[model samples]
Structures are given as C-alpha cells and as structure tokens.
Target: MGQKVNPIGFRLGVNRDWRSRWYASPQEMPGFLHSDIEIRDYVKKKLLFAAVSKIVIERAWNSIRVTIFTARPGIVIGRKGAEIEKMTEEISKMAQGKQIKIDIQEIKTPELDAQLVAENVALQIERRIAYRRAMKK
Candidate 1:
C-alpha cells in the first residue's frame, strides 16, 4: 500500500499554518469570525435606526423645533445619517407603496429627556401606591 496519511491531520495543519496568525487558537477563531460579522451587522442596524429616528423626529417636529435643537440633534441624528435614511427606506420598502409615518419628539436635550423620563417613570412605578393603576395617575 502507498504511504497512508491522516487527512484530518493534514487539514488541521493547513488550517493552522495557512491562515493568519491574528487568530492564534481554535477557540479564538470563532470569536474573530463572530466579531467581524457582528461589526458589520451593528453598522447596518445603526444606520437603519438612525434613518428611522431622524425621519420620525423630523416629521413630529416643525422647523422651529429643529432649529432650536440643532446643536444636540446630532446625537439623535446619528453618524452621516446614511444609516437613518437606510432605516427609513427599509420601512418604506416593507410597507410597499404605502408611506410609513414616523413620529419622534425633539426634546431640548435628548440625554436629559432619557434621564428625566427614566427618573419620572421610576418614581411613578416605585412610589405609586397602586403601582400599575397609579402609574398613569
């Protein structure tokens, strides 16, 4: 018989030697792959969210509100707004010939709104005697 070779061993050696050293271990390989995929997915999702958020907030508020809050608007607006536009477009695409309405409020400060809303909600939830019933009360 000809020289016998372990196919799995050869394959493993090829995988270990031919690939980049950045992924050093077998355990690290999956992590590296997942991270790469995750980053791409995150970027896409971020763009979508930004687009939808911008459209919603813009539709909900008038030019005056936009002008007043322009400085802090960037946070809600997101990077390049490409993602935001992508998100809005995706929604519209899903609706298929019908326009989707998005409503977003433009607070003086978004960061502050979150803090205030959270605090208020917590207070309502925590301090309210009837809890659920008193939440709206």
Candidate 2:
C-alpha cells in the first residue's frame, strides 16, 4: 500500500503528531544563541568614529546614540567634531534610565545616506507645512 495521507499535516506546516513528539523529546545540548539587541549595540560601539562625528556622547553608557548613518559622516561630524559634541549635550538629558548609547555608522555608499536624508527632510517639511495650514484654519 502507498503512504497514507494526513489532512492536518498538509493544512498545518507539521508532520503527524509533531506537537506530541516535540513535547515527548528533549535535546541533550543546544547551541549558543544571540539576540538582535545585543548585536546592534555591539555594532554601534565598534563602528562609531568620534573624530568625524558631528556629535559626541560624553558618557556613552549613559546616553542613547542617534547615529545618522551616512557616507559622509564627515559633514555630520563637522570640523573638530563640534556638531556631534553639541548634539551629545542636547541628547544627554534625554537619556533616562538604562545606559544609553548612540552611534553613526557610516555606510560605504554615499547615495544611500543622501536618499535617506532627503526623504526624512522632505517628510519633516511636509509635516510642518501641514501643521501650519491646520493652525491657520
């Protein structure tokens, strides 16, 4: 006889008695796992370039980093990192509780940052105009 068909298995993405088998079995060992948050934080820390930063965090552990990922981190970082320094002070107070860290990781491609910034600025301008029009009415 050919193999029997299982309707439930076909409908659901599982074999027959998959749940029961899973509950009945236990693995002897499992591989190490990592979460996205930890990885993101690690990347932020490693990728931050303070010299080119337009903003700098006095105490990285105490502030949230808002890195403007860009091909031209130099523009954002500004001369002597003054822009970043000012931004750090402005953001320092905003970091409440949890050790906050912000960083701007530069992308290899400049075009990407340009697109992102343009879209964001355009959105902001649109929102501002909408708000003003509403207020006028």
Candidate 3:
C-alpha cells in the first residue's frame, strides 16, 4: 500500500498551524472537537458567496475568536457591519452562549491561492460554463 499523509499535517509547525486552537482534557475532547467541526461547517456555508478561503477558530477562556480569511472582505463585513453582528449572534448560539468575536483578513493575492482558484473554476462549471472555459479564467 502507498503511504499517504495530509499536506497540511506534514507542514504543521514548519510553515502552517492548525485551524482550531485549544486545549482540552480527555473528558472534554469529544464535545470540543464536535463543536469545532460544526462551527467551521456553519461558517463556510454561511459565507458561501464571500470567497472564504480559510477559518481559524481560537478559544481563550470563555470566548471564541473566529478569523475568516477571504478574497472579498466587503461582503463579509456588510453595510455598517450589520452582517458581522448577525453572524456573531448565530455563532454564539452554537457556542452555547459563549462570546463570539469575528475578524476578517483579506487575501492579498487570492488569484495565487490554490483553494480559491479551484473553487472559482468549480463555480464557473456549476453555472453551466464549459470546463475548458472555466480553466481559462
């Protein structure tokens, strides 16, 4: 059998860090892990059109900090910051009433990001554009 390893795992601590950051005891590990997965899924689905590339979730004492890295920051930060407030409220509910803080980081070179590039092509294809046409862009 061929050996396989996740690229991210291989580079962790070298040039990459885990998306979720927290420490938990054995008794609390399962719940915490599940919550992290749910939170990540919710954020991705909520910002489907915002070109979100990555989400970093950090827990400090009683608060949760969600850092969203996206190509389009304006969409994530809506008019007058109302979108952010709404998202915080929703995520707070998921966090069981814990404080939710959201921070947006713009990707300076989104065109050079592999994940974003792939997502762009997939979206174009989903819109009924030819695969060759999607790749050209």
Candidate 4:
C-alpha cells in the first residue's frame, strides 16, 4: 500500500502558495470565507469553456484579487478584455461591495496540467474522436 497526499496541499508554500493571503479578524472571517467561495464558484461557472487550469484568490484590506490560470487565456480575456471587465463587475456584486481585481495567466503547456489535459481529452471525445487515439498521441 502507498500513502496518498493531495498535490495542492503538499506543494503549498513551496511551488504554490495560499489562496487567501491575508488573515481575517474573527468577526470578518465567516463573511470573507463565504465571499471567497462565492467568487470562485461564479468565476468557474462563467468560464467553464475557457480551459481553466487553476484559480488563485488573495485578499487584502477592502479588496480581493483573483488570478486565473488557463490553457486558453484569450477566451477569458475576450476582445479588448471585455470578458474580464464583465467578470469583475459580477464578482464585485458577489463580494457585497468589495473591490475585485481579476488577472489572467496563461498556461504554456496544457499537456502538463492534469485538469487541462483531462478537459482536452473530454472535449476531443465529445467531438467523436477515439479516446485511445487522443491519449496515445
């Protein structure tokens, strides 16, 4: 038998870091945590077709910063960054008046990312491609 460890948990503070960077006061902790999950879910659902690889959320006094890592940055960015602007507005509403900053980061090698790779394979299969052929390539 082998021990199992979560990749994200194992890598935290090493190659990866905490999502919520700042500490919240006890009175504000619940609201902050709730807003974090709400923002994450809303963004993920809105960008479902954007080949999102990972989402990083950080908090500061009076503001939230969301950095989205995606295999297809252009989709999330849209023409003239319109998509991001709209997303920011939506997230601001979800945050209940906190300022929100959205940043998009591109993943150069989608194949190396497990989520991107799986999504790619699933998309190919949906388009009638053979799973074996897709995986073998």
Write one digit per residue (lDDT tens) for candidate 4, span 1-137: 99999998999989987876779879999988888888888888999999898888888878988999998899999999999999999998888778888988999988899888888888889999998998875
Q: What is the alpha-carbon lDDT for the whole of candidate 2?
A: 0.43
Q: How does residue 20 of candidate 2 score in lDDT?
A: 15
Model 4: residue 32 alpha-carbon error in angstroms: 2.3
**Model 2 CA deviation exceeding 4 Å by range:** 1-63, 96-101, 112-137
- lDDT of candidate 3 at residue 100, scale 0 to 100: 89
Q: Positional deviation of 32 in candidate 1, in angstroms?
A: 42
| Each candidate's clash count | 5, 11, 0, 0
Mind giving the per-residue lDDT tens digits that candidate 2 earns over 19-124?
1111111341121011223333443454343222222222232234444455557755678977666655544433334344446667675434444445445555
- lDDT by candidate, in order shown: 0.40, 0.43, 0.93, 0.88
Of candidates 4 and 3, the better by TM-score: 3
Q: Which residue pairs show collisions in model 4?
A: none
Residue 24's lDDT within candidate 4 is: 80
Which of the predicted structures, 1 or 2, would earn the higher TM-score when compared with the native? Answer: 2
In the range 1-137, model 1's lDDT, one tens digit per residue, is: 89988865578666533211232368655844554344334433553322211211111111101111121345444587553455456544443423433323455554344344454456567765566664453
Q: Top TM-score: which candidate number? A: 3
Q: Against the true structure, what is each candidate's TM-score?
A: 0.27, 0.34, 0.93, 0.82
Cα misplacement distance, residue 132 of candidate 2 (Å): 30
Q: Report the alpha-carbon TM-score of model 1 versus the true structure.
A: 0.27
Which digits, one per residue and each the tens of the lDDT, describe model 3 over residues 1-137? 98999998999999988998999889988988899899999989989999999999899889999999999999999999999999999999999999989999999999998889999999999999999989989
The best candidate by lDDT is: 3
